[model samples]
Target: MQSAELQGILPGKLIHMLNLMRFNFNVRFISVLSLVN
Candidate 1:
């Protein structure tokens, strides 16, 4: 109930936050990969 309501109103904001988190994660992953090479 609450999840659906928030999802309805904040879909764009949620996606933006998720993208930022994924980007930060990818950056960290790449740095670690580079260090191993």
Candidate 2:
């Protein structure tokens, strides 16, 4: 039962983490572009 719950939650958690990483990357990219300009 616990494992099943974890499995259900895992994809959401992974997507959340991926979103965070993408956001961080976008922020960094914008900062670099500003600095370059």
State which candidate has the highest lDDT: 2
User: For residues 1-37, could you state the per-residue lDDT of candidate 1 as single tens digits?
Assistant: 9999888879888899999999999999999999999
What's the true lDDT of residue 27 in model 2?
100
What's the lDDT for candidate 1? 0.95
CA RMSD, predictions in order: 4.2, 0.8
Segments in model 1 whose C-alpha atoms lie over 4 Å from true places: 1-9
Residues 1-37 of candidate 2: C-alpha lDDT, one tens digit per residue: 9999999999999999999999999999999999999
At residue 31, candidate 1 shows an lDDT of 100
Candidate 1 TM-score, true structure as reference: 0.72
Number of clashes in every candidate structure? 0, 0
